[model samples]
Target: MGRYACVVRPSISLVVPVFNEEENLAHAVAVAGRALAEFTSQYEVILVDDASTDRTPEIIRGLTATDPHIRTLRHDRNQKLGGTLRDGFAAASMDLVLYMDADLPFDPREIGRAISAMEVTRADMIAAYRYDRTGEGLRRAIYSYVYNGIIGVLFGWPHRDINFAFKLMRREILEAVELRSEGSLISAELITKTKNLGFTVQQIGLDYFPRTRGRSTLSSLGVIGKIFRELIVLYPEMRHPRRRSPQPAVRPAEDRAPI
Candidate 1:
């Protein structure tokens, strides 16, 4: 008698980094959860709370209590967006890992499209670009154009939306690259590193929506300056190639606060 082998379907881990987004948390999770469910039943949503001073933590506790697939990871102190993302990536446990903003600017359902693209083309990473970016001022627009241009010229990869929040990548790519940025520049760092490592990459378009509940945290001039400074420091590393390292172990959700 021949024995049958179990074929494992691809699973996904959705990482959402939350900071003082109490107003949007419940709705974001609901929408994103429904979107993920449409694609694969084997998935997990990891919410990383960066020590929000508001009622964000309490809201997360309430949401996680009802859903076993929803897990919460808390930072004792507030870390910036980059730190929160690093933790989220480390906590992800599925074959594919995706991270997006908590404000839900892009349609969550697009995640299914991204996963399909990844599978069809066998690409290692899928970078999302916004078609009509709403709710952004002229200053932000100019800054984004200039920043993306600089990255293109420096890295020789002309990806227009380097800082957009929707990124879906294979687990092996994350394991092979080393990420150091702990600010807004983390997005750029991840892309640059992936390109450097010769990973297959593809781009997809997403429709942007205006945020209704919370304001962006990285709009301050100080934050922008820090991102530029980090980019300057990362130039030398990007120019040189290093041996790919083994994938780091997925860190179990730390400070698993009782819901």
Candidate 2:
């Protein structure tokens, strides 16, 4: 028998949140689909449109018309990153769920390696950090450094890139963790709660690719203020999350790799 003939590939739900990404949506989805096929045949690409005011809706319709594996959900109004991902996670019917941004921050081909890491380490969630981020610019780099430091101090997890939009997890983790943040803090909330609730999270390092086609407003002062306001309102709950229903036994997190 072959060395890997018995390995079972898990089904996946690739959740992508988009706003005004008409230029990148179609191409990104196509690339993701191809990459996903390299590992598993059973996968769905869920495109969550957060009330985009562009040709995004038309593009989604065209994609669904041609690809049966592609699915979409749209909001009546802008709900930001948290709400969009919440809906996508709810609609996902797979054993595993992976979240990526519309701009394609990392190579989709890396998806295979992440899955391999999860299987090898028996990790409940896989969080990816960039090997290098200097291409994104100085202001964002400073923001990332400070934000990561604060999260490390408060959460005590020492996660390298809490806000980076590259995370993969088993479906059960999302089912057990109730996420409430409606802004960028959602990522931090997800990672923090998972760590506190006794699930194993493993980190991987990947090459960073900054957005080249569209403008990124995630680093704007307005967004930063909203994240802070949310942090204040949701601090207590995040610090001490109420455990949901019991989950299956998880292995000790001692095997997790360093980023």
Candidate 3:
């Protein structure tokens, strides 16, 4: 029998959005290799360099050269985190998708956990929840409070971390919810929008860790202001059911033109 003739199993596409984090990229890749390879051999790891001004793009190129499974997409202009994710998601082609922070704050073992949960529950989405908060004092507390409170009140909680980066999702769910929030708060935007569509999703508690390098992009003033804006702007979509969820609707390169 040909290799393609066996019973087909769904595969994973791990999408890691990269900015200017040269220091942390290698560690993230290593963890992915250790944790994800056991699940499915037909998987792909997509690294997106969102027009990093630093060595991030170079680092990504190096990884791609050594690993055929590692695919990369680069943006010419510096798009923020959300834009990077949008670009990354568009390029992905797999049955299952995994998106996470490259800084190594969340546990990678949760990849196996999330996939297992999806298989058992047949849930469209599996989100990773932090059992304990990492990082330091007030910033950690404030971030948790702001996002958790907003998520609980605005959307339906019981899910503590709406913005948790580690998520395992089906291609249908990923395609259904069109991702657009082009900044740090895209996680909240994704969770709320997905819940509205009735995706049968669940959260699994996870181990959190401290970032040893690469400064966080979230600022005290910037984050808070953005939160309020999201509540006002993005909240209404949650109020009423949208006709359909976001999915991939791609066009030829020639079609995307100024003319």
Candidate 4:
């Protein structure tokens, strides 16, 4: 009888978008690296620096030089979270692609569970919802409730956390969706579009923690207003009666390669 070997079939590419997150970059990289190591043998971490006017780019470059599994992309100007994520997704080359905040609000270890769910349920995407959101301010809490409600009402998908950063999905799903939001509403846009495109989604609960380093950009009223405006403008185009069918964007094969 021949001995059988278990091969790790699914590799992961994790994207961490950093904007003025110099303080958290090292810790985030370490924790995320350890988490990825626990699950897969083949993985890469792509750090996207969105033109931060701080030492973020320098730190990312140092980390990338030290770790061959770590790669980076930089924007000439601050493009916000949406643009960073788009760039990271486009540069990912693996069976699975995952992204989360550089602040490490959610535990990176939960990534293993997400990967397991993806394999078991065969879901196209798995998003993490914050179970304990007390660390976030009351106003932010209220905004999240209202925003999620609005998304549910408008898009008809009752996802718990539309803006949570811990999203894991197959590479094909990223290839299938044409994401355009360049602001805070990118998370909502991604989830909404994924559902509209007939992709299966799974949600898991994870604990949330307050950032120990830099200030959060999410609590501002300006951001809330922008999200409202985006929702209003995108509602009509996204509400087509027959939009449940998949409408994947076509792109050149080389465009999907990692940078």
Candidate 5:
């Protein structure tokens, strides 16, 4: 930890949530280690195992034993992606927080770009955008329309790829927003909240990869139906001031602009 302090830029905490991703867990972790290695001189990787039912936890143990920068946190039972991310966020010890997928859907190397974007641009959050994606072609297309349209039109968030799990957030923004969704939609919620809070956001292009194993949780019709319901009922919860325990800390912006 001491050695990392000198070189790690803003102390990065990489939070990856896992649930039954044992097959790809090790690969994701390995890529994260390599990417973060080039990302900065110092950093810590936190693997949040959300009660995996396979060898995921065992693999995590092995990973921790070999890498000092890697550590594992376990959830007794399945907490779902949202819960896993919340747990990871709570356990993060770095000033800059990164949340990514355990399925290796995005290029880990883009992490360096995100870190650089934040440091150089003075932005509080960097959201990664995907050019081409995977999964059932129709389903991914539907997801794009639902998420991007809703957040852009209703919430007015300056976000392009709301479904992307890869994000770099400053500690201040992390502490400010209370993430409550136990599923994937929380990704969109975070973008909406940050924009509503008037935080500066930057989007960067990222490589999208196909998932070889395991299946996505939602179908095209299934996701569209769910998000629409969430749109009406969840807006309040997402923007809830009471939900964020201490409330979002303000940095006294020199000028407020539309997000």
Candidate 6:
């Protein structure tokens, strides 16, 4: 923590999306809360539960009662990653918003470094890329590499990791853009729109930690199918996104003759 003593410590809303994460939610929130307290006193952890059928809801109730900094949002039914994040981001009311997985894919203490990076770079968003992901297994590593390369080529926005679950952004960035993906493509959608809208985005490298509790499902066939479906439907809109405000219309050529 001493190394992060210079962190700017902006008020942050940590948005975690969980579904059937009874094994990880409680411990994850507690750990994240402790890490957040290290740098900033003004912070809140919003756990958006996508109608988990396990004991997760019970655990969330217990956590909310025990931790004042913890709050939660519930969905009547599962909404996958994108919808869950959209609701969570909408609920965030802080200067900064951080999106991480309930499984705690990376060290929460690294959050301070991200804040410091944001401050140093003056970027509107700080997206983290895994320094090394071979820990997750070779298959996942290959999948991620191919996915990132394809995204970079298609979107013309090359990034180290577009779908990694570590994105720190300013509240204004969320307010300025409308995110519409209901699946894994949401991350790509977010980064693309942020860049398209003329916001500075910076990336930092962090040690990756694969989930040790519960099964990993984001790479399932169904989830990957949904990602492609959303990408196809949203491609045009993302490429030619409407500006937040209408640009000044150029006067007719004759009207500018005196210039």
The lDDT per prediction is: 0.80, 0.85, 0.73, 0.79, 0.74, 0.87
Flag regions of model 3 displaced more than 4 Å.
1-9, 244-259
What is the number of backbone collisions in each predicted candidate, taken in the order shown?
Answer: 0, 0, 6, 0, 1, 0
Put down candidate 2 lDDT per residue, 175-236, tens digits, no spaces: 77888889889999888888778778999998889999877968889788888999998888
C-alpha TM-scores of all predictions? 0.89, 0.92, 0.85, 0.88, 0.84, 0.92
Stretches of candidate 4 above 4 Å error? 1-9, 240-259
By TM-score, highest first, what's the ranking? Answer: 6, 2, 1, 4, 3, 5
Sorting all predicted structures by lDDT, with the top scorer first, yields: 6, 2, 1, 4, 5, 3
Give the Cα error of residue 142 in candidate 3, in Å.
Answer: 2.3
The number of the candidate with the highest lDDT is: 6
Candidate 2: stretches off by over 4 Å: 1-6, 245-259
* Tens digit per residue, CA lDDT, model 1, 156-257: 879989888889987766777787888888988888888887777899998988688887878799889889888888878866654356545533323211
Worst lDDT window (10 residues) for model 3? 1-10
lDDT of 4 by residue, 1-259 (tens): 0121123436889998988998999899999888787776589999998888988888988898889999899999888777889999999998789888899988787877777677666677899899977777787788889888988987776889888888998787787777767778888878877777677799989888879889798668877777777777776655542332364453443454221
User: Under the 3 Å rule for N, CA and C atoms, how many clashes does model 6 have?
Assistant: 0
TM-score of 5: 0.84
* Candidate 5 total steric clashes: 1
What is the number of residue pairs that collide in model 3?
Answer: 6
- Model 1 ranges with Cα > 4 A deviation: 1-9, 243-259
Question: What lDDT tens digits, residue by residue, belong to model 3 across residues 1-259?
Answer: 2222213235878898887889999889888866666666478989888788888988888888988889988889977767888787778888778888788777676666666677666677888877777455677767777768867776666567776678887766667676567676678777776777776678888887767899776555776676667567767775555634333453332352110
Model with the higher TM-score, candidate 2 or 3: 2
Select the stronger candidate by TM-score from 3 and 5.
3
